[model samples]
Target: MRAIELKNVSKIYKNGVKALAGVSLTVKQGEFIAVMGQSGSGKSTLLQIAGLLDDCTSGQIIINGNGVSRLNKNVLADIRMKSLGFVFQSFHLDTHLKAYENIMVPMLINAEYKNKSAMKERAIQLAETVGLTNRIEHYPGELSGGEQQRVAIARALANNPDFILADEPTGNLDSKNEIIIFEELKRLSISGKGVLVVSHNDAVKDYADRVLTMKDGILEHTDEK
Candidate 1:
C-alpha cells in the first residue's frame, strides 16, 4: 500500500512566492526515499506538506488512504499526532526534560495513554533501540549533539508512527555522527516505517531506495546509482 500520495500539489506562500509547483508523488509502505535539492528548491515545503504540518494551495494528499487536504484543524492535529513523525535538522528536544520524559511527551499529549508506567516502559525501549540506553535520564543539556539527536529520533518513534518525515537529519552532525544517524534511519526503514528525507548530502544517496531531485520547486526522478 502507498503510505503517501500527492496529486498536483502546489504551495504558494502569502508573499507571492511559489514553494511547490504542481508536485505529485507516491511513497509505498516501508520504502526509503530521499529528496535531494539545493537550497530554496521547495524540498522543505514538500516535507511539511507530506507530514501534515502545512497545507498545499491546490491538490490532494492521500496518506494511508485518508484525504489529508480537507481535514479540519483538530482532525489534522490528531492525524499528525497518530500517523506521522517528524525529525528536524535541529534536534527539537525539550531542554528541561530528561531523554525518557522527552520521548514520553507525545504519548502524554495524546491523552489516551492512561497507563503511565506502560508509556515509561515504551520510552525506555525506544531509548534502547536508538542506543541511548545509558542517557535515558540525562537532560538535553548534558548530552552531545549526536546523543540529543538520538533522543529526538527515539521521541519521533514513541507513537509507532506509520512513517517519518526527516528534514536534513544528518546536516547538523559531524562525519562520524552522521554515519550513526544514517544507520539508525536505515534500520527503521528495514523494520517497515516509511522514511521521507530531504537532504543535500551525497552521503544519503547510497542509503535511499529512490532519490528525487528538485529544481525550482519541481521534482524529477533521478537515476540512482
Candidate 2:
C-alpha cells in the first residue's frame, strides 16, 4: 500500500518556462511505470520532482501517506535517503572507488548499518543481485557500459529503499544491455519495489505495467498494458 503520490503538480522555472503542468501520478510498490517522451518534454522534470531531488513549483507530494510539500530540507533529505533509490543514465559511481566500494557509498550515511562490515556485506549481496560479483573489485574505468550500469543498479539497492526512480537508465548502452537493464528493473518491481522509469526507448513498454506519455509539459496519455 505504500506509494508516492503527486497531486496536481506543476513546475515553473525562474526563467518563466513551465516544465510540468498539472500533472498527477501515483507509483505504488510492486508496480513498474514508464514515462516516455521526446527530449525536453518534461519527463526528467517529473522524475526529479517525484524522487524529491527537486521540488515542484506548486501542488502536493505525498510519500507513504505523509504530505511532504511543507517539510524542511533536512527532513526531506532523510525521507529521500531512507525511502527512495535513484539510478541515472550517467553511472554516477565515484571514479576513485572500486565497484563494491561505490555500492557502499549510500550506506555510509544510513542509520541501518552500524559498521563497515555490515555495509560491506550488504554491498556484496547487492553486487551479487546485479550479477556483478566477479567485478565487485574492478574500477568503473575497467568495466564496460553494461557493467557500469549494473554497478549503478547495485548502488541504488544498497539502502534497501522501497522505490527506485531511474532516469534514462540505459541511455548509454547498446540494445542487449538495454534489455538487460529493463529486465533487472522489471525483476525489482516484482520483488515489491515501486519503479518509475523515464526513458525514450519504446522497448520499455514491453516490461512496464503502465506506460505514460509526456508531451509539451503535460501527461498526454496513459496506456495500461
Candidate 3:
C-alpha cells in the first residue's frame, strides 16, 4: 500500500500569511481523493506541498512510509520525478512540439529508458491510452482544449509514476470536457495510481472515493455521496 501522508502539516509564508494549519491527509494508490474549496482557501497550496513542489513550514510529509519533510532538494527532486506525476489547469504542453513529442519530454530526464526509440514507443502508448493516437503529430496550438488537456494528462504519466497531483485540471474547459478529464483521472486511479485532485467543481465528488473540503486552511471530511 503505497501512500503519501501529511501529518499535522502547516505552512506559513515569509509575510506571515498562514496558508495551511495542521492539515493532515493520506492518499493511497488506487484511490481517488478530491479536495474542493473556494479560491484562496489553501487548496492549491496543499497540492503544491503534497506534490513536493513547495515546502511546508512545519510538520511531516511521508511518502511510501518514509518521512521526507527534511530531505535535501536534489533527493526531493529525484523522488518527485520518479514517484509522482502532475497535471495542471493550464495544460502545460510545449506549443512547438507535437503531442507525442510533448509526452516524451519527461522521459528525457528519466534514466529508465536507454534510447529514444523506447521513449517514443512509451509516448505512443500513452497517447493511445489518452485517446490521442490520431492526434499524435498535432501541435498544442492545433488541438482543441479537450485534446490538449488529454495530451497533458498523457505527458504526466510518461514516467509511469505511482501518484498524480492535479490542480484545477479542467478549469479551462467546457462541461463536456470537464467530465472527460474527470473520467480519465478516475480511470487512472482504478489502474493503481493514487490521485489527489484540487478542484472547485462539485462534479468531481461523484468520481472520487473520498471528498474533503478546505476552508480557511483547515480540512474537513465531507459525507460520502
lDDT of 1: 0.89
TM-score of 2: 0.98
Q: Candidate 3 clashing pairs? A: none
Please list the residue runs of candidate 1 whose C-alpha ends up more than 4 Å from where it truly belongs after superposition.
none
Query: Per-candidate TM vs. native?
Result: 0.97, 0.98, 0.98
**Model 1, poorest ten-residue lDDT window?**
216-225
Question: What's model 3's TM-score?
Answer: 0.98
Whole-model lDDT values for every prediction: 0.89, 0.93, 0.93
* Per-prediction tally of clashes: 0, 0, 0
Candidate 3 has its poorest 10 consecutive residues by lDDT at 216-225
